[model samples]
Target chain A: MKKVIGLWFALVAVALIGMSAVQTEPGLAVGDTAPDFTLRNIDGKMVSLADFPDAKGFIVTFTCNTCPYAVMYEDRLIELHQKMAAKGYPVIAIQPNDPEVQPGDSFEKMQERAKEKGFPFAYLLDEGQEIYPAYGASRTPHVFLLDKSRKVRYIGAIDDNPQDETGVTRRYVEEAVAAMEAGNEPELTFTKAIGCTIKTKKKG
Target chain B: MLKKAIRILGVVGALSLSTFLAAQEEGTPFPFTVYETYADFAPVMAQDNDTTYVINFWATWCKPCVEELPYFDSLHVNVAQKPVKVLLVSLDFRRDLTRKLVPFLAEHPLKPPVAVLLDGKYNDWIDKVSTEWDGAIPATVVYQGGKRIFHGEQFSSYSELTDLLAELKQ
Candidate 1:
């Protein structure tokens, strides 16, 4: 019995230690300056948030390949990216979940997904997850929108509802973009995202 | 045709059962006990005379919480010398206590003290835990000397756990 307890204790200890390794510098909220990062896109082109400067705004969604919810929202993700990009508000989908831990989320697979879906936006890898915390993204499909000045104007879920598109009570990302286009502060600034938690790759 | 349908149903049933059983077996894997009652949480923290507590509230359906469980279990073992107590309070429904949870913990062979919180009302207990919390999954608090520090969201690093422990020890 004692041995059994000890083994279980060891397992829980391992899990907690793993949890702590994720260095969260908290997140940038409304009025906070956006953090810049250079990451590789599916096309192997160098991409940076700074590249989007002079644009009206940008939608940065922390997304992954395989979470059921993330996968379910693919079409909307595509639509949102295209719809906003047409209006000079581009979308940059960054995958913060570690690919080594989740093999399907690997950069190679990401390239395949981008090719398969003809991704309208840059699907970048947040290598080492350095830039995700600046936006406080803990889940795939989380979104943060930055205005022309590089100040975060809106943050939160991609939409109000996840399971049912017909029941979406709030169009957070869309409204934020509309608010910017109309020269107004986004009425709703943030909401807890509805999606999979980021699976930061386990370290040795 | 009937046999084929039954065979298909049986295969699906077996797969689901195995998955269900798999979840319950790994629920508790730490030495310190986890109490599930919300009323008991503050009191337990209040009762410990010379111990620091790393209290984590999680659910099986919560991915980050699940991913981070093994780290807490490890802390329970390694820091037993600091003799810090670790508690894992599962936010899963009481209905799954016996059928799903207990079995899951048993399979994972959790060592920590585990408790199943029965509070169904998030509104009542949400403020009690912390006012800043917005009812998100994977919430954790490390308490020492009667002071509480809250950490929300999933964490997955041993160094982060150690650093928090080191600060509380000071």
Candidate 2:
């Protein structure tokens, strides 16, 4: 009887372990193919990577309303999205943070911020984290740049300066866009992205 | 009259400075122990005791780190029921440990289970925390049940907390 009970207990433990692996996968490395996904915009319209086929490149930035670092880059991202969209390179902003987890990162708050900023790009919701892991998003404002062929060419911080853009020595996203447009590879393609930790659902 | 005014200003400044230092001294929730280097704590981890540690690396100005403060507070409180421990290892400028970080954490009322990483070579220890880390803020490592789970995001929901604890319990 003791042995039988022990075996049953072990099976229960194993099943519990299996459930966790099904949950979340963070951290992606270089050369990863951009994961294609669809998310709703502030206007409640669906937007996906396929929406920007004619673009020379795409900027997939994971950001939210409350992160100061993200807020700092809001204008720049909007400007870049608009200026580059006309040039066939648009930015698709996604919020990977769970609205239920972070009150500030709610879809309503995201929409409010996007509308307030006059964001030209789509601020999509990465619900269920279907797209966050694919891009290896770790922080608010983490950026991934894809070339015309839809292959990831740059992944990292938006720029060298998160606090003050005036002192920025490098523009990783812009440089990547320039390289792709010039039919050349970006010289510097990545940086240590520093910002708010991505919000995730808690375990029961 | 001008000299008298100057003297009064100096006296006020000195008095406020002393009060600030006193407040800082009183704010420490844990018993005071000093370590000169990271190697000092290496043996504790090496011993692999039943102690579970949540080593967080954060800067003084990191936004997400500040936002997640309440979460870690609850985490520290919850895990205290077990043999678990949370170590808030600040990566803020070492020079600012006293002037900025300590005072900052003190002002914010960070309860015990916290310490500042005084090492200068961030490059060396950053990789030791997590390989996939791109030197981001709010990075945390859960050392529990003889395993370490490196988490790079701020967990805002209760499930994340329970999930981390559950993962550690395993």
- Candidate models: Cα lDDT each: 0.75, 0.72
Model 2 chain B: lowest-lDDT 10 consecutive positions: B28-37
Worst 10 residues of 2 chain A by lDDT: A23-32
DockQ (Cα-based) for each candidate:
0.05, 0.23
For residue B46, model 1's alpha carbon misses the true position, in angstroms, by 15
Candidate 2 accuracy as lDDT: 0.72
Candidates in order, TM-scores: namely: 0.58, 0.62
The i-RMS of candidate 1 is 5.9
RMSD to true structure for each model, in Å = 14.5, 10.7
Error of 1 at A89 (Å): 1.1
Worst 10 residues of 1 chain A by lDDT: A193-202
Best by DockQ: 2
Error of 2 at B22 (Å): 10
What C-alpha lDDT, on a 0 to 100 scale, does residue B13 get in candidate 1? 61
